[model samples]
Target: MKAKVYVTLKPSVLDPQGKAIKHSVELLGFSGISDIRQGKYFEIAIEGPLNVDQAREEAVRMAHDVLSNPIIEDFRVEIEE
Candidate 1:
């Protein structure tokens, strides 16, 4: 089983890296770009005999406990078979 976790900054947070990318894009002639945010992606592979549901539950816990900061970041988890 595999878990894909997407971690991104909260909407209220500022993203300097994303801003730099946006500026670079504008300098390259890209127009009408409003905002950009940077994020993190994690793919965690689980071994053992746990079933899909069990693995999903564990993955959710992992996402909450280890993968994201509740104050500044948001995260989503997807289980891949």
Candidate 2:
């Protein structure tokens, strides 16, 4: 089984990095971008006899506890088998 986790900052939080990227993009001649947000992606390989549900549960727990900061970030998990 494999798990994919996407961690992102909350909407209320300021994203200086994202803003810098957006500025760079505009400087590169890309236009019409209203906003940008920075985030983290993690791919975890589960090596066990766990089923899809179990893997999803484990991934969600790990995402919530270890992969993201609950105070300023949110995360979602996906499982593949």
Tens digits of lDDT, candidate 2, 1-81 = 789999999999999999999999999999999998999999999997899998999999999989999999999898878
Candidate 1: tens digits of C-alpha lDDT, residues 1-81: 798999999999999999999999999999999987899999999999988889889888888888998889899888898
Q: Give the range of the ten consecutive residues with the poorest summed lDDT in model 1.
A: 58-67
Q: lDDT winner among the candidates?
A: 2
Model 1: residues with Cα > 4 Å off, grouped in runs = none
How well does each candidate superpose onto the true structure, as a TM-score? 0.87, 0.97
Name the TM-score of candidate 1. Answer: 0.87
Model 2: how far residue 48 lies from native, Å: 1.1
Number of backbone collisions per candidate, in order? 0, 0
**In terms of TM-score, which candidate is strongest?**
2
Query: 76 in model 1: Cα distance from truth in Å?
Result: 0.6
